[model samples]
Target: MVKEPAVTLHLTRIGPSWMDPITNFLENGKLPDDEKEDKALRREAAKYAIIQGQLFKKGLSHPLLKCLHPDQTDYVLREVHEGCCGHHIGGRALVITRFSISEVVVSDNGTQFTNKKFTEFLTGLGIKQKFSSVEHPQTNGQVEAANKVVLLGLKKRLAKKKGAWADELASVL
Candidate 1:
């Protein structure tokens, strides 16, 4: 009997520090005696959140240019596909990701994945792309769970150096 390839989902996200201040303010209302400083922090955090939300709405999420260049993305996808599929050319593998434009380009109006080059790249590598359902995270529950595990591990490993997530990613992984 032929065994099926093991399916895997790669998950990535912006660091927690980017959203912590906003979440703290949301839950606690405001900070004591430092209203002006707290307000500024909250505003900056909210701005970042809004920008991220807009990007998500436009089918663009993690693995941004700063995180991974398009060429690097192609390389990583190829490596992961081959490694997970026993290095078989034309082996079938499915990749599930948020509607990140870095992974999949949506049309100008956000109606569809309109990037022919990306589609062709996947086709060439015998890989299939699936986007998590809008507002339904259960579709990618395993990956989500894995993300939490990684974050927890990183939190413990990094301690107070939160901004060093990228630097410590290799050890975390």
Candidate 2:
């Protein structure tokens, strides 16, 4: 058997703070004391969402990009970064297979599922798309689970607060 290379660990060089005053404020109905600090904290959280997209798009090595569908070459940069705030923090893409499979379709109206660029790319590739029922997450089991994982990770990273739990999808098929 060939020996596999050891898995390397990566530090974000970015911070993660999940439970912050804004979170408490949003959840428990306590408004932010200083709007400046609140905005700054929120702005910080937004960076990770953007950074992850950047890492996938601009930062990926050719080999890594090869792992994604030809259609998704610019998908990371386009889908993740090309939405308005309150809607930008969508999920990452799941390749699920090789050689031009169907693209992902989510029912929920957020960055991942609702972007024009994403849909156009998938359709351009001649792949079919499907959606889980909106508001009810169970329709998309893969996404729901992925969301949990990303959210948990984001929470750990932020340690203060992140914005939302958008699409975090995957599929065994």
Candidate 3:
């Protein structure tokens, strides 16, 4: 515990969620054509509808790549996205409604976990962040499943189309 990592890596990729449009439809109360839709906006929107975290894994992974040094931090908080995606509260809340609000959440020190502002948000909101054992991915089962579904949806939709995966994701997802 004496040696601190310079940067703790938490990697996650958010492509597209097929259920995005559905949620938009429900939220917006109106529909727009493809040309009128916002790709960047929708991609971010997907995060909200399907914002599930890996069972025991941190949510954000982008910060992992920006390793200023290999050894600096006292610990590693491996997560995907710290503020929104890493937490996975939206997705859990969607399914469980009031159940997950009362469940215990354990986590290791990923970037999302170590963030001061994020921690303060969790504390103010009364959300729990617990650190589990290292490398035990099974804890993040919901995230794994969610990632798989997104990947599968992307493949199934774009497989028959003629365009870039990212480009086609809005329509498919």
Candidate 4:
């Protein structure tokens, strides 16, 4: 009879994960060399907990959110945004889910913004809705200027390949 040795597998992080600093501090008490970053990490690490070798964020109003490494984020994003359980949420829904609704909202006079249900929702929440003057779009000059810059960048980058502008927006920003 021949005896074979048992094999063990070891996994390592190839690229720096967003969870590295927090996980290291929570698990190994390691901190960066910079004083500012060390202080910041300490502050941020206080809200996180390591349980059963996994990191979770303690939310004030929500339940503990499991922290995932960068490599795992894509799967989670896909699952939440377009997978079987997803509802194909748009930017407004994403913002409302991730952050508290503001006291006021500024938008253009588009039909989407002027819709009855949206107006009633804002009114129910006691959120003041403000619209830029239609005659003078310069009322929202800053936002328009920023949009113009982004469009120009996309135009230059996507000179002959307009179809890929959506993929390149993050880099341009």
Candidate 5:
């Protein structure tokens, strides 16, 4: 009998599975000031423990931004590049982003990335850029899937405190 080749899969846990404790602490019914303070401290300590344990692990993690402004997009890209590629910049990775106006400019002739500055930044880092088709998300399915996980985690963590998503992003990621 012929043996089949082994398949290897890599998985990264971006956040801790301490949602119940966090939710309980966040949603603890109107408690006394002292009790609430104690709970808050405990929750923070728990979060810190989780974060410390997972620091510098290999993963594609990004913070939740309130908007997709060009500056914000650029910051996210820089963070990803620094965290993932480190000193080895050029041609290390092909970045695929959605066809947002801030990311890519659409023209009758042909579509191109937004501007020289952003292009030069990527070139300096030796990274290649690719844009997903305007209407076809499947072109970046892997990234979209990872994004879905991150969004879902953010949603779960934020719960009723939707506006606090940005604040809890680090913990969630």
Candidate 6:
């Protein structure tokens, strides 16, 4: 008779999730030793709930939004970005992959676009940043026309299913 080796399998958490502290506090009344940390945890835990053993954060639009672990966030983002219903034009990947160095970049006067690091990058690349002016009819008209086209496309793609508009946005673009 031949002897076979036995394999042992053990389940383990890849890493401690952001929700661990809140979940532990809500479930088991456990709190951190630090005074400030424990108080902060208590305050934050009030915004979350344990429903059917799953953690959910309170939201504005909806009552609850299911919270996912850090490890699972990437998978969820990928699915929403490239899955069957998704068109893959949105998310951080869009900024990373689709952008090209341009001579003149037109953008709104948002803090993000005007930040020091972004300004330094543009200056280093010799790119001129043009902030779209509300007073300029020509620039505003062009932007409005572009927006109209996109809105029309989205409207045609989704007649009554307004919720799927995000997934259909890249296809329209």
> Which candidate has the top score in TM-score?
6
lDDT of 3 by residue, 45-162 (tens): 4444312221111136422222222232222434334532466557656775644452344554556446776465457558776665558767566544554675587567667677
Instruction: Please give the range of 10 consecutive residues that has the lowest summed lDDT in model 5.
Output: 104-113
C-alpha displacement of 72 in model 5, angstroms?
50
Residue lDDT tens for model 5, 1-173: 74752322234432444343433444553333587776775655443222322211122364421222232345456655675445653552534332222343222112223456545544555666665565755545655665567558756656656454344343433
| Top-lDDT candidate index | 4
For each candidate, what is the lDDT? 0.46, 0.46, 0.48, 0.74, 0.44, 0.73
Better model by lDDT: candidate 3 vs candidate 6: 6
- What RMSD does model 6 have? 18.1
Q: Write the per-residue lDDT of candidate 4 for residues 65-139, one digit (tens) a residue.
A: 987777767766776667765777688877768877569877667665577766866687799998877787676
Q: What is the lDDT of residue 157 in candidate 2?
A: 57
- Flag regions of model 4 displaced more than 4 Å: 1-14, 86-173
TM-scores, all candidates, are: 0.20, 0.24, 0.23, 0.41, 0.18, 0.42
Clashes of 1: 3
Off by over 4 Å in 3: 1-100, 135-173
> How well does model 2 score by local distance difference test?
0.46
What is the per-residue lDDT of model 1 for residues 47-122, given as tens digits with 9 covering 90 to 100?
3323322221112554322223233456567766666555654423323332333343221212223355545544
Task: lDDT for model 5, please.
Answer: 0.44
Query: Which of 3 and 5 is the better model by lDDT?
Result: 3
The digit string of per-residue lDDT tens for model 6 on 72-132 reads 7776676666665377455687677666867986765556556776676667779998788
Query: Cα deviation of 171 in candidate 2 (Å)?
Result: 22
Per-residue error (Å), model 6, residue 69: 0.5
Ranking, lDDT, top scorer first: 4, 6, 3, 1, 2, 5
